[model samples]
Target: MEPPELRRAVAAGRVAASELGLQVDDVVVVHNSDRVALRLVPCDVLARVAPVGHLADSEFEVEVARRLNAVDAPVAELDPRVEPRVFLRDAFAISLWTYYEPAESEIAPTDCADAFLRLHAALRHIDLEAPHFTDRVAVALGEVNDRERSPDLPESDRELLSGTLSGLSATISTEHDRDQLLHGEPHPGNLLNTRRGLLFVDLATCCRGPIEFDLAHAPEEVGDHYKGADPVLIHRCRALNWAMFSAWRWRRADQMPDRDRWRATGLDNVRAALDRCHLD
Candidate 1:
């Protein structure tokens, strides 16, 4: 959505909240991407608006958080007073959540790993249907090869991405680790060290996969801290994730401030992953 349209949607969200008896004295834009986050003040609530088709994943995230909270899991809590339902208006889907303020210091990788382990355990109890982790891998590869999606992607890099994705998929399919519910991306960026301690947010990527898949985005220290983690599987997952992320960067390079820098770094990571896989 464009700036004017997003501002309109944010206004619509505030009005929608008012209808539900939630008073919004102010509205602050927290983040914007595929979705827009508005921090509704006085009530201290968050309103997230996304396109219609995208609501399902956001709804799933809310339900998963509800279940995890029941188990005393350390995750971003939803506003329980309001029914967690996706509201549709003007082609946008909105959901309300309790706002969280992070501490001054960033959350350490060790904290992220510890919180992820707890969150993962609680998520296993959620019996909802979720996409497999590899499903995203396929999607990323698709974007890399799609001319309209990645019009600037070089032919040589496209071939390299395709080949690397196939090899990674093969390795993932043969891994011996037990599959379970995963936080999907447990990197430090997705975690917050709040007054309540470390809380995992952005459950939209929650999926069913080997625990190593969740650890792939985390720092090496995080992988080391996680007990019973399969080192070899973690390494393989890292290689796979790097390839996928590299494709993602390439696909969205146009929107980045430093496209050349990002493209260079992404391609470098892709090459590194390919080299590591060959060594193995």
Candidate 2:
């Protein structure tokens, strides 16, 4: 009835269907495209497909993750392992590394802090290098301005996008200029909880950058709206950073009037975050 959906039934299990060659009657629709995750019932092995455009990056990330998390690594030694590894794909923005696996978890406060340190530590030692991440961010920024290309966006949003980029360029140029190995996009969704402490998946945006750029989003800032495996407080300073970052992003995406966009959605999200624990 329309253009193809991306990774619609990815890690939710359809790929498992292919690998298992399950009987035709066994497949169930767990999710639809451009929406929440799906649940494919009665599936033993969960298999997922990478988003079509993200195919290359997703594949690259999986390879890097497998290599970085290889047998000899301390992350593996310290973390739990699953037999016959399985990962799931869920369209353009998300990918499931693995799930519900268990591990000796860290204390609440130190969870993300320790995880960030550990992630950077592992990244520092990994032999594999993921470059194009810079190019990806650039492209994604351009997409924010590409209204005609985005059916969900309007013309006003396109213009607002232009302004946001200008602001982002200035702020990031002066602020996030440091070069450190980072998880790239370390939002809450990127971190997974397996038996072994917390395992990070979704390295699509992984790259070299100011460690703050990644750590800034920590469980508190990025996942402020919801609960995650990591314990967190509503730290406004960092939370504001993420809020502005996103407002500028949406400002570019919807091309809304400059002030209204941020004040309404962007600042609002930030405010919600700031009010979360009311640190001040």
| TM-scores of all candidate predictions against the true structure | 0.90, 0.58
Best by lDDT: 1
Residue 128 CA displacement from its true place in model 2, Å: 3.5
- Worst 10-residue lDDT window, candidate 2: 73-82
User: Residue-wise lDDT of candidate 2 within 1-280, one digit each (tens)?
Assistant: 0124433444334554444444223433333322323333433322334345546665666556666676332232211323333344343333332334444453354566667666776777776666533444455456656554444444564444444444443444454444656677676655655565666655546676555556556654333323332223224224435443553444333332353554456535544654663522
Candidate 1 residue pairs in backbone clash = none
Write one digit per residue (lDDT tens) for candidate 1, span 1-280.
5688678779878987887899988999887766788999899888888777787887888777778888898888877668877788777888888888768987676777788788778877777778887788888889887878888888988887777777777778665547788888766767777888988878888877888888878877788889998877777788778778668767753344456687778778777755655633
lDDT for model 2, on a 0 to 1 scale?
A: 0.47
Stretches of candidate 1 exceeding 4 Å from the true structure? 252-261, 274-280
